[model samples]
Target: MRRTDPEGHGPVRFGPPLPADGLPVLPELSAVLAAAAPLGGSEPVGGGPALLEAACAYWARRGLSAGPERVVAAPGAPSLLLALTAALGGDVLVPRPCAAWWAPYARLLGRPVFHVGTPAECGGVPDPYALLETVRRVRDEGGDPRLLVLSVADDPTATVAPPEAVHEAVEAAVGEGLHVVSDETWRDTVHAPHDTVLIGPAEMLPERVTVVTDLAGALLPPGWPAAVARFPEGEIADDLHARVLDVLTALGARVAAPVAAAAGYALTEPEPVTTRVAATVRLHARVAAAAHAAVVPSGALARPPRAGRHLYVDLGPLRTALGAHGVGDAQDLEEFLTARLGLPAPGGHRFGDDLGALRVRLSTGSLLAGTDTELEECLSSPSPVELPYTQRALITVKSVFDDLRDDAQRWEPPR
Candidate 1:
């Protein structure tokens, strides 16, 4: 289960990308890029006027009013976040099992990162009580806790935080004089938009929260490397936006010109982009549910998949069986499951969770997509979960967990 790339070829990536989603670029996106490629020129740092305006429209739809001057765009969310972290300095606080890539940016700035435990209901926002206590403890120990990063629609664990939970967490953070960064990357990918109550911190505390969305989570492919951030508008935002722009300028983190054009178009939410995103959400929703059904039936614990393309399964209930198979911790479980299931399953350790916990994030993207042709078929199929190729993939997942269930029954000692 060892994965290695040759040295001196390229730098290794450190982040939460659960392998690439192998789906082809939407034909509409490709057309936009092709047309925009010819008018290529460097995009201004932050973003061009058009891109920023489109970003405003996007945010406006989400019940957050933002002006073009208050938005920023970068090649990726990590870059925008890094710039944000640099611009607003101090120790960073993140949920215990935050996005795999979150805490690293704070460390890049020599800022201490403290992991706060999440509430039982969700994995994105920290438990409100724990957040208050952690902030107090950090300050008492001379750690300047100034930033809190959370997600309403989270990765690894695909559950969306309830609006009440988000409100309490935001209140706890801002009450302590800390700013919030709400990563809404997966907001548009909600499996059941009507059933979920997602409230970004920005909606509650406009002046203190910054919203970041990576288009890869829905509108664009990952390789395109486009994301946008919205800062709250006020007199203070002028300085904050300029500081972030300065950081982007120094880091050369501008979105490529063609990417800017495509992003601007995507942000406008045209029929094709909207339709593709809707279908993709539906596709992932079906596969994620099937994956969850597979794991939970084997006595594994998992939050229901409400958003995004993955499920976070805690196999602690099957630890005896897994340990019998020499899978004692998250790392070993990651390797074992990936090797056995033939998918890219990443351990919870990658997301700052305890290494001893037998937890992993299973991506539906690779599970349902064995070939490009099959991907297209599933994407268009009326009942994708029942489609031949998709059903085969689901069977493969179910078989692995069924084996684990059998092993658990045989391996665990009777009371």
Candidate 2:
């Protein structure tokens, strides 16, 4: 029952997990690099013409009508978000327990942030009723809450916002005249392709929404930073697009020529790229489900993952037991898990959740370990978790939970 030392010799360093590598590299990358066509001049601030066309085509595939003129590309989603916030200057409203980076970016821009709690079914968008309430409250306090940021298919919680929730939140935000920024980076990574019911705010209220997507999430290789934004059509969209470009140009932020070419090709949704994305979706879903199952027996509550590479775990049910071991808050729980399991599970507080909540975001990407060939083989197998590399990772995760639960049952705090 003694606490394990995270830095001790026996601890397992689960990760700091990188994004999975089972997806195939785009074949167009070689040709694009060889041609070296885009390297000569600076791309337009919004994006180069070829990249914009590909982005338009990408959105078209998703059932949203877009033109090349409406698309803007940036080095990555975060940079795009920074530019967007600066361009649409105002206080930001985000769901409590949102992607870890959202509030931080708002703070960096010196904008006040209001965190509204999410609905029970999802983690990205705020609860519909709560959204209006938070906005009113912030405005009453003399704050200009003009921007609402969200992810339709969320990251830390790994759940997609249901269609009804999306509609209600959008209706509420639009009513308040708050411009919406929907980060749809993980929309393509849904585990069950048929189960995806994402109705982006852009589709629901196009004129009021700006859609941002990170290609690195599903298509491009890790470290290849590229993302695109689809602004709503018309004069307002044009103005925002211009402002975003001006900011990007000032920052000297442009996606590299070779990377832009690779991005353009992937955005075309080539068959190979789509197939690889499907494989990743399947692999991550299975691994995350296994991780979820492993922790549940220890009294951890987790939503079954629907997309992306994370699982949000709440140890509140085990609070009494955890508290006996001096793990009373989110920070304590995070440190305890890291020490015992060597897992880099960040506490919910980092994502704007209450510090006292016993929640942590668990990244499941480490489960896809081994060389690319081995990972690709695992992805192809009917039972991926049974493969040696994956199985070992799952087993380690389960064993940690088992040990924690066993220790919890045996330990008693001194009166």
Candidate 3:
């Protein structure tokens, strides 16, 4: 998992495929643990009252109003998603090129999954028109597409859906009677708070939408693995909440007591946590922008990252040049980059993109490689990306694209 850039060429990651350097360690975490009561001998079927109350306050800050009774917690968002998929008991509609875990989780629960293309602006919510068509096509073929999962602030593509688009997509899904799971894990990670617009489906269609938040992404440390869901007030919501708890109970799943204590404190968004989150967002945006600048003019097609820690790269433009080197598809592209540039990125095929698309998800997180003290300095620095450590990572990324572009320009097809 550790691939050295060789001669300080770039950064390397060895953990869960997320930005590692900027992982914030909350100062309050230890105090929260110290104050927490000993774990009871029995596990709670769902999130305890304290955690649920904190979750409600977290959502309220973003304009969604809910009480603790409507909130349910799980070990993490993925676990909650699994329980929800099983409880809902029908086909699932997901965006083409979504978070890597969604499709696989649905399959594990034995639910059929259909993909709808995303709007040009983002990768989480499906394209409104395509969503309706896909739903109809599935139902016509006797596949009951009953759930639509999306992220208002998306992953892989790193673009936030416009408020208008969120409204349209939710309207379409609700009109078709699909229960929507809106993943807002990255909502608090918006790079530019003022420039980005995020409207959760729960805000628009509370009756039919369940908002899932992963605290690890924006608040807590990634290793903690805590998440909560806000359900709309209704009999169906009540029943689904109970079913999810039952499933979690069967699986012997519960967020660790200490982690749950941290979650409660983090969800309240204390000033220190907010400051750290904002700093992390700014760091990612700068590094990703630097990487984007290097890739776009070099014949790769990529959307300028607007939020989160990634950029979606399409290498179709270099197909001829790549094909000359036996790199004509997504898998080939992934291997070629890792072998040639010492960079490792997940191919689009893993996210339900076409195998031949030559697309890859590039994470800027690795740009944050260094000791904790160095990373903290980078976060606090007004020009973090300009620091030697961070600058070298960016330069290495730019150099890879520069070489690729040169090769493409000089390449001549074989007879």
Task: Please provide TM-scores, in order, for all candidate models, with all chains considered together.
Answer: 0.94, 0.91, 0.92
Runs in model 1 lying further than 4 Å from the true structure:
1-14, 18-21, 370-373
Candidate 3 vs. true structure, TM-score: 0.92
Q: Compared to the true structure, candidate 1 yields what TM-score?
A: 0.94
Enumerate residue pairs that collide in model 2. Answer: none
**lDDT (CA) per prediction:** 0.85, 0.80, 0.80
lDDT by residue for model 3 (1-415), tens:
1111112112222112543435547677767865764753322767888888888888888798999888888888888999999999989888987887777678877778887888887778888999899888887777888899999788778888898889999999999999999988888878888977667898888999998888867877777778999988899999998898888998877888888888888898888778878888888888889889978988999988888888889988888778878987777777787776565676777677777788888888766768878888888888988888888877887888877788888885665
For model 1, name the residue pairs that clash.
none
Task: Rank candidates by TM-score, best first.
Answer: 1, 3, 2
Listed per candidate, the RMSD to the true structure in angstroms reads 4.2, 5.6, 5.8
What is candidate 2's TM-score against the reference?
0.91
lDDT of 2 by residue, 98-129 (tens): 87667656777887788888898888998989
Candidate 2, 379: how far from true, in Å? Answer: 1.6
Best by TM-score: 1
Mind giving the per-residue lDDT tens digits that candidate 1 earns over 175-242? 99898999999999999988777788898889989899999889888989999999987766678789
